[model samples]
Structures are given as structure tokens and as C-alpha cells.
Target chain A: MSNANAALAQAQSGAVQRYGFTLGCALLGLFLFTGCQSGGQTSDDKAAPVYEEGQSLTMEGTLIDTRCYPLNKDVNRGLDHERPEGFVKACATACANQGFPVAILRGGETDGEVWVLMTVPAVLADYMAEEIRVQGTVRSTGVLIPERVETFSDGEWLTVL
Target chain B: MKTIFSLMLAAFLFVGFTSEKTNQVTVKGKLIDTKCYGMMHDNHTNDHMVKKGDKMMKMPSCATACAGMGIPVGVLEDSKPGNDVHVVIAPAGTFAEHMDKEVRITGEAPYAGSIMPGKVEVKNDKGKWVEVEVAGMM
Candidate 1:
């Protein structure tokens, strides 16, 4: 073959090899990214932990009224909540007194999971908005049957119920 | 004899550790507000008391109102005052209108006192069980 033709063919072969290498790397990167995304459980997945019935769990979180928390996480995840009238704010204790479900805002996070307490709501009225530690059995449905509950007060943990 | 005893002990421990399986049960009872029942204990009626100004008065259909406001509703098994109360975890307003009605709930009993209901049926005036539509939780 002529010298110029041989050189042109050699250059074209190198370019093709480089393009193949780049495409292979891109496909591998895409596969790895998708694999990582599906490996971690999302918040909507119900079988995240696959908890057994009566499985014991101990968690620390803030006490919150379940009724209003879902309405407004920032406004109702505390001692006070916005009333249905849209013009009045009410205390969570009064709501709990009227038999609203009280739940624990896990890790005090507004975006975290809120597990409803299976115990008496009226008894928890006094401890609203406090940081609570609960030792209990958790249902697969995510409700907590609290066996022992304590509150963080004055730099110490005190048993409340 | 010693080997047999060791095997038996191991089997007992394995069964004890893994025996807490989820149980599906059907419970029949009257739906009651858990708050009132938990506080008063003896107040099992459908009507509850509310304070108006300085006086406490009976509020008719209070159980329905309370259940509508996201209060946990429980099933008083056999409609008895002192029987086992199984608290149901469901959508907020699912049991609002069914207060004080005879209900049959088929669900998973994660524990002794809590139910995750799959189907709930109430007895109509004609004495027939009718399934109620449950709202989907967000």
C-alpha cells in the first residue's frame, strides 16, 4: 500500500478505538448510577425494615399532634397548632385532651416518619412538644405500642408514662 | 441423653425467638372513641360530655365528631364496657360515621391491642353487613 493511505488507515483505526472506549465508560457509569439509586430504600417503601410483629424498638423524637402536623409541619409540629378556622391558633394540649392522636415526629424532623402512639392520647397532653424517648413494640403498619416513655427535661431524662 | 437435651434446648430457644408472627384476625365489636374510653373507662356510650362555659353537658354524637378530628377509634369487643379494646390505625376519617355501630374488622393484629385494618364492615338497620369504603392515606 502507499505510505499516505497506510497512515490514513492507521489514524482512522485509533479514532474508532477511542470512541469505543468512551462509549463503554459512559454505559458503565449510567448502569452504576441507576444501581445505587435503587439500592437504597425510599421513604414511600412500606417494607423498608421488614419489622416483625411485636418487634421491640427504641426511638427518640419530639411529641406532636397528628391531626395538624400533616396539615402544616412547621406550624403544627409543636405545642401550638393552627385551628381549622384559619384565623386562630390553638394549643396542642387542648387538642390531645379532645382525643386527637398524638405521634412522635421521629428525630424531630419535619420530613421524617411520624409514628402514631398506640397508647392513650389524653395522658400525653401534658408532654406536648417535648423531646421524648419511647421504648416500645412497633407494628409493621408503623404504629408504636409504647411500653415505656420518657421526656428530656432540664438536661435529664425523666419517666413520664 | 446429654446430646438430646442440648438439641431440645436449642429448639426451644429458636422457637421462642422466632414465634412472634403477624396474626390476621377478625374482630366484632362496637366502635368507640379511644380518648373518652381511655380517660373515663366507664363511659362507653356514644354520647360524650363537653364543657360549655362553666358547665359540663352531654354532647350528642360526640364520638363521631371526635373520630372525624383524627382521634384514634377503638373496637370494644362484644360491645362490652370492660372488654379488650383494639385500637385501629387507619385513615383519619375512616371511622367517623361508624361510631357506636356494630363493626367487624378483618386486619393484621401486629400486637395484642392494635389492628391494621384491611376490611371493615358495619351492620345496617336491616341487619346485614355492608363494607365501608376506606380512604387512602397519603
Candidate 2:
């Protein structure tokens, strides 16, 4: 094989290994939460899936890590609501880097559900703690599989996807 | 000309990569499944909203069930009345033990978002929030 081919093969292997490791950790998270699933969906999970593909959703809120979002439960934990503009960006950015799934906290009246990013973890991680607009499909599992992600930086809509 | 184009590309990539950071913090709240909490308690019309003497009784059980189904568990901090936020807890061995229970964890916090816990604590029988050992440290 050519040197270039050998390098490409090595890179692909590394990526696959990383992806497997992350997926393993996420699945392990599932196991820790459930123990061993004996059957179908849990009783509480019976509610129909809210997310749908091709559904147009424009949300303005901080990007967050899925695991920690509900646990804290305080929307203004790092951002001061009084100011509404104050936020600690480092926290969200680091949280995603730690292998947690990135999600969006939709601002306004919809306080109940958070948009879980099912598409690209790395791309969404960049906008942590920063307000942005997301357009995507909502999977039955309540995850937002994004098709387009944009952030208003310096009055410009910067598209991440 | 090639160098100019390369520099422009590098600048664009730099902007893309440079815009990121995360915060570290210590927090306390009840651990519950996202689906259960959002669909149940958050939605007043939902049947799970059944209240007994002003408290929702089914929350704990529902949270436990959802957690078992591989759903992510999060901490609900109600410190600020109207601004309640959910921070998803990373599942470690000790996490399952504290499912649907109150916990105090110290880790990286993003503004008002999730936590990548460095240390976690759960209340013991005596009612003290003592640190518990997790299989892995996030």
C-alpha cells in the first residue's frame, strides 16, 4: 500500500476506536440508569415522541450538556437572569468535551423539554453557553437530530453545520 | 497567491475552533430521568401530575423506571424558584444507586447547564451529603 493509503487507514482506525469508546460510555450510562431492561419502554416513557423530522424549530437558548442539564435544574446557574446576558461559556464547552451529549435549552415558555443534539457532538460543542438557533428533526426518543445549527456572533448568523 | 488563500483558510478555521470553553462548579439537586420530569411534572395536563396533598407522588417511581430503560438521569436544582434547570449527571457505578435521590456533586458546569462531575455526594441514612465513589471521574 502507498504511504498515503497507510496513513489514511491508520486515521480511520483511530476515529473508529474513539467513536466506539464514546458510544460504550454512553451505553454504560444507560445501563447504570436502568440496571437490565426486562422488556419494552418504561411506564414513564410511554408518552409519544415529541420530535419529528422536517419540523421547523427556531430556538434561542444556551447550548448545554445533556447529562447535567436536568440535574442542576437551575436555568440561571451560570447565567444571571437579572442581566440575561451574563453567562459562563467555559462550563458548557468543557462539559461537552468530557464526552457528554450536547443539548439546547430552549428559551421562553418552553421550560419543560430540552433539545438533545443527536447529530454531531463536536460541532455543537462549540456553541456551549451561547445562544443560537437550531433547525432539525425531532426523533421519537425526544432527541433533536439537527440539520442546521446557527449562532448569532457579532450580529451574524454563523452556521455550524 | 497560494499562501494568501492558505492564510485565509487558516483564519476561518481558527475562528471556528477558538470559540469554546466550559465552567466547573459544585451543585446539589434531585436526580431524575429527563423524559419523566419533562413530560410528567413539567406538563400539568399529564396524568402523572396527580398530586396528593400538594406533592406529586409518582415522580420518583417514574424517574426510576425511565432511568432503568437507558434514559439519561439529571439533577433538578430548584434553588431559584422560577428558573429551575436540569443538569444531566454522568452515569457512573454510584449513579444508579442514587437514581431518583438527592445528590450533591462538584464538577465542571456550563453557565446554567450540565455538569461533568469530578466528585459526587449522596445523603446517607444519617442525612449527611457524603461523597460517594464513582467508577470513573468525569
Candidate 3:
């Protein structure tokens, strides 16, 4: 009878050990999977730092033709070029209509940053060289893909709906 | 652990340097206000366009107005179909007086397209291309 009791006790202990080992393996697998997945996600997020397509941006500034701005035609020697006459609305409109890419000149601390504006020429040409409000997307190359344009009138920016 | 850290550092440095590469190039082209140039192309038929007696005008006054009013000026490398490319000039202030004129530019070529100026030359009223001395164009 004592032998039988001892045999039964041994069998129970063996079963518990096996079950514990299996449980530990499963828990370890779950932990490893979760850890790797989270790690992969973080890596992917940092791999590329670029603007997403069609990301919306709104800005206020003067419209311009990218062709006739500061550096003129001497892009290589831009510092040596001279533009004495300031922003010309007529010329901006004409250039924008003639298929030159338009842009907005944003006032910065030291200089104005030109955000290349892209949209239907006919629509944007009317506001060329004008101080207007615009809403658009930031293209990967830092171009502004305007979806809406507005003008400041009577202390309010009226949307061109 | 030390070996693993060294391998990781090596990989990071490789990516940091290889990801960004710049190229230098020299381009010869006309520096013109893209607007006035295009109006000339359109035959100056409409009043809304820059015109001299219903013709596209290369008048400096028209070009100057456009540049001052925030018009971007660019270099038109070639007008040939399928080969024509215009690059918008940065720091538009430096080229203010050279609108609708021919100029030589040296600068960085974008990875795929257009050149940005580091140095510029424009023709004087005497038709001599003179290297301009600009102070802090940007």
C-alpha cells in the first residue's frame, strides 16, 4: 500500500512539472512575439522621415512665380543676382498663367521661405503676388499643393469658395 | 554585448552618411522672369498679360514689377520639347535686377532635377556678362 501511494505521488508530480514547462514556453513565446512586433514598429517609424502624401497645410503669405524671384536665372550664383523691384503682382499673375509654378513667400526671421504652390494655374493666377491665405498639402519636395485660397478683406480672410 | 553594440553603431553610421548625397553642377541658361517670358510666348494677346502694343514685351519694368511682388525667377535650361526644364531660383532677392536677362549659374544639382545657384552672372546694359557681387541674398 505504501508503494502504491508513493507511485501515485510520483505520477502527480511528473504531470505538474510537464504542465508547468509547457505553460512557461507559451508565455515566453507570447512575450517574444509582442516584443519583436513592437520593436519592428518603432524601427519602421524612424526609417523614413518624409512628408506623407496629401498632408494638409494652411499658410498666409504673398503669391509668386517661382521663375522670377530672387536668384533670377543664375541659380548657381544666386548670391550675385539682384532683384531691386519688389513683388510685382502683374508679373506674378502673368508668369503663373504662363505655366511657371507659383509659390508663397513666407516671412521668416532672416529671410522668407518660398513654398512652391501647385494648383490649377487659372485658379491661382488671379491671386498672384497678393497677400492671401491658402490651404494645401505639403508635397515631399516641400511644394504647397493648395486646395483652397483666400484673400484678406476688411480684417477677414474670405475663402474663394 | 560589446561586439553587438559595435555592429549596431557601424550600421547607423553607414546609413547616416549614405542617405544624403549632393552633386555640384554648372548650368548656362537665360535668367528671366518666368511670367514675362511666358506672356511673350502667349503672343501678349490679352490685356492681363504683359504687353507692348498687343505683343509680348521684354520691358524691364514689367519684369521688375513681377519680381518685386514675390514672383519666382528660374533658369530655363532648354526650350526644346521634352527637354525643356525650368528650375526655380532660391533666395530670389539676389537676381532682382537681372530679370528677363541671360545669366550663367553654378550650384547644386538636385538628385533628379534642376540646379540651385551658388554663384550667378548676368549681362550688364553693355551686353557684357558680369559676375554680380551680392551680399546675403537669402
Candidate 4:
């Protein structure tokens, strides 16, 4: 009777140890994940810094073409380069995926407008030169059309320098 | 012992993550040179004719008349003489109220063909230089 009681006591202790080990592993994994990328929002995921309004006045970014390259030329007349069909949608999707918008600056020259863009403003639909530096970390919530035509379709519509 | 270990790990993570910083960028350039020059100039140059005429008339408004349409039109400001003033702007709405004037615009340097604007700087109503467009544009 004494031996059996001792055996039972030992088994209970063993079970407790195993449970605790499992719990410890789980807790450690949670801690590690908190600092990792796929985990919930952490300080690492903080958005880009914001810019002040009416600050030192110059900003730039890539010149995004809003035109979709159509397989058929008949519809291309009114399409031109500027007011293309899916330009808005492509930039929006790219912005969402990248977690930022594209920022660009326009020079004063009419013929040779330079497009030097900074990241984070990639998603915006419209921007002007002086306005770029003033507004920082502002994800422009504007219009974006269908997704299909904006991203993958390529027709060489607008040329950017 | 186990509690101490977990606490230590938590502390380490907090320190590392809290130190992370965000990015704010600064960009600068003149809009004088870009590939979309042709379209931006054309739209502003003959916007009146494009809106009023039944036919699509380009600058000089003579093309429409030569096409046998004799459409009444208004002349936008002539583009700057020197190539140095050549800058491209975006779609028609970028210039706000002043978008129609092709003669001499001193406002935001709009991206010519971009669906979105990269930067904006134009003369305000007070006549002082500002980065944004003052009036509502469609």
C-alpha cells in the first residue's frame, strides 16, 4: 500500500512537469513573435515620419503614368497619356501593399520637368511641387480605379525623365 | 527561475522595439524637364477650344479652322520662349483656376502625366508663393 501511494505521487509530479514545460515554450514563442514582422503592430511597424506644413519648401518623387496600354489602338485617342484608365488604381494598390505612398517634386521648367520622388507618398493620386514638402506622412485618400489595368498592363503611355 | 527568465526576455524585446524610428523624407527638384511635356502643354494651351469647339483644336486654334471648322477660340499664354522655362504639369485640373493661362504661370510645379501629383507650388491669391492650390479644381 505504501509503495503504490508513492508511485501515484511520482506520476502526478511528472505530469505537472510536462505541462509546465509546454506552457513555457508557448510563452517564449509569443514573446519572440511580438518582436517579429508577422506579429501584431509593434513600434517597428510605425509609419514614416510626418512633415510640417509650410516647412522648407521642396519635395520630389517618381512620375507615375496614369495611362493603361491598350491592346487596341482605337480607344487610345482620347486616352492620351495623362488621363489614362487605371493609373489611379495601380498606384493605390501599390501604396497599400508597400504601406506608403510615392512623393515627387516638379521643377519650374516647363519642357524638362524633373521627377525626383521620395518613398511613402507612393499611393497619392495628385501632387504639386511646393505642396510636397509641406505635407508629410499624409496618405492621400483619393480615387483609384480598377486594379487589373493599373498594375500589370504595360503600354508605354507616358515617358518620365 | 522560470518567471525571472520570461521577464528578462520581455524586457529585451521592449527595449529593442521601442527604439525603432520612422522615416520622413525630403525631396527637391525643378519641374522644368520631364517626358510628359507635350501632353501637359497641349491641354492648357487650347483648353478653351477643346471645351467650346465641337472639334478638338490644338494650339494656334488654326488647326481647327484649317480643318474647315472655323471654330471660335481663345489663346492661352504662349509657352516661355527659352527651353529653361519648359516644365510639365499633370492633368487639366492641376493649375486650379489658373490652369487655363499658358502665358506665365507661377504656381505649383505639377507632375505632367502622373496620375498623382508629386509636388505643388503656385502663387496664391495673396500673390505670395505657396505649395498648394488655393481654389477648388475638378
Per-candidate iRMSD: 17.5, 20.8, 11.6, 14.5
> How far does residue B23 in candidate 4 sit from its true spot (Å)?
20
Off by over 4 Å in 4: A35-42, A45-47, A65-161, B1-138
Overall local distance difference test of candidate 3:
0.55
Worst 10 residues of 1 chain B by lDDT: B1-10
Better candidate number, 1 or 4, judged by DockQ: 1
Q: Residue by residue across A75-97, what tens digits does model 3's lDDT show?
A: 21121223455534366556555
Proportion of the native interface contacts kept in model 4: 0.01
Which is the leading candidate under lDDT? 1
Query: Stretches of candidate 1 above 4 Å error?
Result: A1-47, A87-90, B1-71, B74-122, B128-138
DockQ scores of the candidates:
0.04, 0.03, 0.05, 0.04
Q: Provide the lowest-lDDT 10-residue window in model 4 chain A.
A: A139-148
Each model's chain A TM-score: 0.69, 0.53, 0.52, 0.32
DockQ of 2: 0.03
Cα error of candidate 1 at position A5, Å: 46
Q: How good is model 2 by TM-score?
A: 0.38
What's the lDDT for candidate 1? Answer: 0.73
Which regions of candidate 2 are displaced past 4 Å? Answer: A1-161, B1-22, B42-60, B78-83, B92-94
Q: What TM-score, to 2 decimal places, does chain A of model 4 have? A: 0.32
